[model samples]
Target chain A: MSVEAMLQTIKLLLPALMPSWRFFSVIAPSPRIEITLLKTAKDTPDSWQEFRPRPAHLSIGSMLKRMFYNARWNEALFLTSLAERLSSNPTEHSSQEILKRIKAELVRNSFDSFDSAATPHLQFRLVFVHREGEQLQKHVTFISPVYGSFGDTDS
Target chain B: MSLDYAIRLTEILLALAFIQQSIEHFRAPRDEQRLFIPRFILSILLLFGFQTQWVCLALVILALFILRRFQGPYNGGSDRMGLLVLCCLSLINFMPSSLWREYVFGYLAIQLVLSYFFSGWVKIKNPEWRNGQALRDVFQFSAYPVSEALRTWMNWPRLLVVMSWSVILFELLFPLSLMTPTTLIIGLVIASTFHLANACLFGFNRFFWIWMAAYPSILWLQQRIFIVEQL
Candidate 1:
C-alpha cells in the first residue's frame, strides 16, 4: 500500500489506542492501577499487605515498586496455602519452604493455563479502572496456580 | 553577549560535560565494563572534537547558528566535509560488528522519523485537528506548575495534537523539504518545538540545544553559505 493509504488506516485506529488528548494534558495524574492494587491488598486479611503505593509516573523506581508488591502478595498466599495442604501448621513452616511453595504456585498458576511464552515468569495481577463522567472506579483480580507440577502439561 | 561568545561558551560547556562522562565510564565497576564501552567510545569522539578537531566541530556549530540567524543563505565553506568525518567516526566507534552499529544508528533514525511521522499521522487522522481543537490542547497541556484559568477555555487535546502532529510530519519530510525555502522554514519551526519540548519535559537540556544547532544550517542555509560542486 502507498504511504498515504497506510497513514489513513493508522489515523482511523489511533484514537482507539490513545487516551483522549485532554487526559495526556494533566500534570501527574494518580495511577489507577496502583490504587486498585492498594485496595485489593487491604481487603485480603489472610495475606501480608505491607506493599506501598508507588508514585504515578513511568520510571525505573515505579517499575521496581510494582514488581516487589506483586511478588510479596504472591509469595505470602502460596506459602499459607501450601502449609494447609501439607497438613502442617502455618507457624511451623520455614521461610525456605514458603519460597519453594511460592515457586510451585507460580508454575501451577501460569504454566499451562496462560500463554506462558509471552508472559514473564514473575507473578502479576491485572486491575481495571472504569471512568464515568468525572468519577473513577477500580476492580482488581488476583490469579495464580492451585497445586501442580512446574511443567507445561495440564493435569 | 555576542553570538560568537555564546557559541564559544556552549562549546566549552559541552566539551567539559563529555569529558566528565568519559571519566565516569572509566570509573565504572569491572562487572559493568561491557556497558561502558559504547559510552567510552562516544566520550572519546566528543573529546577529540573538543580538543584536536575543534575547528571542524565549531564550523558545524557555527553553520547551525548562521542558518538560524540569517533565515536565508550566508557565505562560508560548507561544513559537509566536517559532517561526513563526524559520521564516519560515529560509524567506526560503533563497528567491528556491523550489526551493533546498524542497530544503534537504525534505532536513532527510526526514533527521529517515527516521532515525527506518528505525531503528524495521528493529527491529520483526527478531525479535531482540522477544526483547531488540536492547537487548544497544546496550550492547556503546556501550562506549568500551576495551571491558569485559561485552560478551561481551550480545546485541550485537539490543539496540542494538531500542532504536535504537524511537527512530526514536517520532521519526517525534512530531508525532502530542504529543497524548498517555505518547506525548510516549516521543518525548522517543527524541529525547534521538538527540541524545546525535550528541554522542558525531559531535561535533555544540552542535547536539545546542541543537536538543534546543526539542523537550521544543514537544511535551510546550505545554498546561501557555500558553493555546491557538481559531481
Candidate 2:
C-alpha cells in the first residue's frame, strides 16, 4: 500500500499520528440526538427525550474533577463529531458506527437485557441547533430509520 | 530542561491522559467494549514509569485498538496529541543514541510549533475569524460553550473582536518566540494560558492536559535545537 494509505490504516489501528491542526473551520449548525420509543412502525411516538441532557448546574468540584475524569462529556463531543461526519458524508464508517452504538445504547437503556422479550423499537433524529440568541433555536435535520426490537441488526 | 527530564514529564502527563481515557473505556457499562483490564493496568504502569519502552509500545497497540473502538480519535486533537506524545516518548526511550533522542524530541517541538502556526495560518485567511464573527458565533451558538451562562461573553462584541485578533496574532507570530529563552518561555506561558482558557470555556480538559504534556519536549528542544539554529 502507499505510505499515505498505510498511515491511514495505522491511524485507525494505532492512532496518535495526526498532523492537521485546523479546528472549527467554519460555522455551521450543531447536532443533538433525540429519540422516541415506538411500539410499531406506524406508531407516531409517546414522547421524545434528548439522549443526553446537559445539567443546568455545573458544580465546581465536578468541573475540577473533569480535568482527570470527563468521559461522559467527551462521549457527547464524540457523538457530535459523528453527527457532523454523517452530515458531510452520509456513508462514512464513523457515521454508521455512531448509529450502531446509539441504537445499542438506547436499547440497553430501555430494556433490562438483550434477551428481553419486549419488542419495542427506537427512532432517533438529529436536532440541529441552528442559531444562537437569548434562546437557542433547533430543527430536525435527519431522521434514522426505526431500529429493531432488540437492536440486534441494522435498521 | 534536559531531554531525560522532558521525556519523564511527557510520560507521566501522557499517562494521566491515558488513565483518564482508560477508566471510562474499561468500565463504561457497555457490554460490547473489549480490553478492559489490560488497558487499565498499562495506564497505571505508564503513570508509575515502570518499563518505559515496553509499556509505551504496549499502550500504542492498545491505543490503536481504542481508536478502532471509537472509529476515530475518541477526543480529537487531545487524543492525537496524547498519542503523539506516547509515540515520540517511546521512540526516545528505545533509541540508544543521544543524538537520535535529541532529534526525536526536536521533531516533536517542530510539530508543536507548526500546530500553532497552522492554526493561526488558517484562521488569518478566513474572513469571519479575522472579523471576530466566527469566535462570536462560537461563544454564541457553538456546541463548545460549557454552559448557558458562559455564553454571555458573546454579548461583548468589541472584546470578542480584540480577543479574536490577539489569538490570531499570537498564534501567527508564535514561531518567532522560539528565537530566545525569554521569548520562548513567554510564548509557552501564553500558549498554556490559552489552552487553560479553552478548557475553562469549552470544557475540553483533555486538550489542556495533553498539550501540557507535549510542552516539555518543546522546552528541551528550545534550548538545544531552536535556539542553536537562531544563534
**TM-score of every prediction relative to native:** 0.34, 0.84
What Cα-based lDDT does every candidate model obtain? 0.36, 0.76
Colliding residue pairs in candidate 2: A13-B64
| Model 2 docking category | acceptable
- What ranges in model 2 sit over 4 Å off? A1-8, A11-18, A45-49, A57-61, A91-119, A129-141, A148-150, A153-155, B30-33, B226-231
Candidate 2 structure quality by residue, lDDT tens digits, B69-112: 66677788888887788888878888879999988888888889
| First chain TM-score for all predictions | 0.20, 0.71
Q: How many backbone clashes does candidate 2 have?
A: 1
> For candidate 2, what's the RMSD?
4.2
As a whole number from 0 to 100, the lDDT of residue B126 in candidate 1 is: 64
Cα lDDT of model 1 by residue, A41-136, tens digit: 223323221112222234444333432122332223233233232333323223224334434444455323333344333222223333433344
What's the true lDDT of residue A118 in model 1?
Answer: 41
DockQ for each model: 0.03, 0.45
Name the candidate that leads on lDDT.
Answer: 2
Tens digits of per-residue lDDT for model 1, B1-231: 222232333334344433332343343334224433443454455545544344434433433332332221111111122232233324434367755543433333333334445545565566645555545543343322112343453545555556555554564465565565566667667677765554333222333433443342243133332234322
